[model samples]
Target: MAKAKPNNKVDPNKYLKNKDIEPEGKLGVAAAVGRMGLMLVGIVGIATEFFRDDGWLKAALGKLFESTSSMMLIPVIIFVLWLLNRWMSSESKSETKKSGDIPMYAMMAVGAYYLFKLITTGSL
Candidate 1:
């Protein structure tokens, strides 16, 4: 009896085997340009505010709030980003993941606390 040959055949013209999928160098340049554009817009906004004839002190205090708001938002943003990345990377599509909810809930609780405090203190 003749031995049967194993079927290991694959199509050579598949999309994965195509040579036209090379990474473009312009992608990095486009990313850098986008970042620079954001930076320029931010600088322009700040300059317009600072050079205005209105209250300089209030402008300065507004800057302080901007920085403080960003600091307060950083952890929440990080938690959300982590949760999204984890969900995206999970292999079990049918089952839902629940690892990152605690941080998000905690952040919300903290925000509610601050909001309540502000309202109680007549600062809101």
Candidate 2:
């Protein structure tokens, strides 16, 4: 019987315990989880708002986004766009590509528009 040699190379994440390979810090994990959780909550809230047909701008947004007033949408669209810009810029590539942030950003923009409307116009 012949014995086989073990492979020497391995994935650094799986093989190494060095400081550089480690996470920035424990708080990073907490912050990331918190951000993702908050995003999820926003998504679910809007999704719930959709099928109910009375939660506000859910249908209007999910549809072609036929808002009754453009004046009402202007500031909100601007603000949400700004927020999305900041959010997307700060995020890492893995997050932007794989973390589902784009769709989330889109949903957040819609939700934010309605939220802004809800706050300012007292309607959505």
Instruction: Choose the strongest candidate by TM-score.
Output: 2
- Per-residue alpha-carbon lDDT of model 2 for 30-123, expressed as tens digits? 8767566656656765666766756556645644345556457878988998886775564565444433467766665665666665678875
Q: Give the residue spans of candidate 2 off by over 4 A.
A: 1-19, 53-100, 106-124
Off by over 4 Å in 1: 1-24, 55-124
- C-alpha lDDT of residue 64 in model 1: 55
Pairs clashing within candidate 2: none
Question: Tens digit of lDDT per residue, candidate 1, span 12-77?
Answer: 776666676767589888976655554454444445555777746576556656876756766787
Residue 108 Cα positional deviation in candidate 2, in Å, after optimal superposition: 5.5
Instruction: List lDDT for all candidates, in order.
Output: 0.61, 0.64
Q: Cα lDDT of model 2 overall?
A: 0.64
Clashes of each: 0, 0
